[model samples]
Target: MVITVVYGVLAVICLGYFAGIVIYTQTVGFALFWLLTGLLLCAAGAYCAYRRKHPDRLEMPLMLKSAVFTCVSVGFLILAAAGITIFMDTEEEAPEDLDYLIVLGSKTVGREPSDTLKLRLDAALEYLQENKKTRVILSGGKGSGEDWTEAQVMYLYLKNAGVQTHRMVMETQSTDTEENVIYSLNLVKKTDTVGIVTNDFHLCRAQALARKQGKTEVYGIPAKSNWFLLPNQTVRECFALLIEKFMGNI
Candidate 1:
């Protein structure tokens, strides 16, 4: 009875969360994951209830049940551990003095920076305004529906924010975070103290990749993430961190 109640409640909460994201962000791919898992849990709960009400209908081996339970338990534990690691890096302060700032790219609508990109740009602008000596490396490639490369968009945005052209460098060939680190780091010398500018939820993986790419002294200048998208993105970041680890990308 307790198990049924827990599963049923989780399923409802999951579905409600999914609806919340879709309604708020109009985004789909990232939001589908938790919703699907919740529905699966709902099915599982239904099966458990059926087994209880109609014991003779189907008999499950105790070992199979134990295995399923163990897998779910272990999965939650792993996610919790990853969440902890991610949260520890979320509010990292950008060092007062820095040689280089890496403003990582995000989606752009036509030539305009997307909301996420805007937050990064704003954060980078604030940092640059305060740290006059810091040079910036704008990283990202052109994606569909984008009128210009991500680097180009960031370059213009920063330029408009009063960042001098000479203080900024553009690395336009990279399309992903690993490439962002690889290509951007090349533009800056090894001795430079690098700081990555991105949303707070993304700092952990971004720093990890920077470290993996041999920039061990790199730091994160985390920008504010949109509150409406925060829950889904935070959860997504856990899976992303795990994958990056498995692939040795970070």
Candidate 2:
């Protein structure tokens, strides 16, 4: 009964988080993960209730139990590895006087930066202010329902923030992280010491993607994430890291 109640509470929390994310972000994205997890928790709770009423109603075959255990074990291991990787570089600092700093783009609202993207931009702005010689590549294409290319939005934000036009280079054609690295790298030599700016939860994957594309001196400059969204975003990044590994992207 205790375990059953715990599962019920967990299910409600997950489902409520999912609904809150949808309402706040106006997009589903990986909030589906929360929805699915909530449903599975509910099912598990139901099973526990049934087992309480029928203690010996059914027993699983040993072989089938072994298979299920193996699957669960493997899944847990994968998720753990991905979570570790997602967080490994969250506190990294880029070496000074980098040849280029790549600001990977996220969503923008109309002509303004999204909260996530603004964090990246602010981080980049701070770094660029201190390291005036480093040019920045604002990388991202127009995503669905956005008012302009993400790169363009970033460009205008930094410009108004006092970063000169010559200091900003726009790679406005890449739609995702891999493409962000690929297209941004094309604007400079692979041997260049580059820094990638992104939210803290995304630093590892962004740095890994740069290294995968033959960058030898790349590093990360992590921006703070929105506290309320950090858990959801980090869990989503773990899945993304696994997929990127499966697709040979990082």
Candidate 3:
């Protein structure tokens, strides 16, 4: 009876979790994975409830139970580790004197910048307004769905926002973070100090990648992450960080 009640409660929680992730996030991989796992939990709960009513039925095999427990424990550990990385922050507060600022790109819809990209640009704009001597590098290639290259869009947006054309350098050939750093570095002198401007959730890995590329004197300039998309983005970044770790990119 106790096991049945516990499973029933878990089923409710799992279903609720699925609804929240699917409806709120609308993110592809994360939402779908959560929803499917939730449905499986719901089914398992239903089976448990049925078995409680018929105690003669066999329980879940011990090996399967152990596997489930192990998977859950490992998942929790990974999540906890990723959560700790959020606070392993670098020098996020914009400095008054930077020789170069590399503003990383986000997705662009048609010709308009995504909200994520806009926030990074807004941060750069503020820094540029205060530090006129700092040259800017807008880094991103044209993604498949984008109408314009992210770098071009950022360059044009900042130009209209009062940053001088000569102060901006567009790096449109690189498609990923490694290339973003590598190509942007090529445009500047090795002796030059750089400020990495990216979303707050991305700062830890971005700085790690910079250091991997031998950029020793880099400062992180974090932009505000979108509140609605924060959960999805942070979860996705955790997976990305894992890949970067395995690839030895960070």
- Shift in Å, residue 198, candidate 2: 0.6
Q: Each prediction's TM-score against the native?
A: 0.90, 0.93, 0.86
lDDT of 1 at 71: 98
Q: On residues 153-222, what C-alpha lDDT tens digit does candidate 3 reach at each position?
A: 9998999899999999999998988888889988988899899999888888888888888898899988
Clashes of each: 0, 0, 0
Candidate 2 C-alpha lDDT tens digits along 106-217 = 9999999999999999999999999989999999999999989999999999999999999899999999888998999999985678899999889888888888888867
Ranking by TM-score: 2, 1, 3
TM-score of 1: 0.90
Model 2 residue pairs with clashes: none
Pick the lDDT winner. 2
70 in model 2: Cα distance from truth in Å? 3.5
Off by over 4 Å in 3: 1-30
Question: What Cα-based lDDT does every candidate model obtain?
Answer: 0.88, 0.91, 0.83
Q: Write the per-residue lDDT of candidate 1 for residues 83-172, one digit (tens) a residue.
A: 889879567676887999999998887788988899999999999999999999999999766789999989888888899999999999
In candidate 1, stretches whose alpha carbon ends up further than 4 angstroms from where it belongs are none
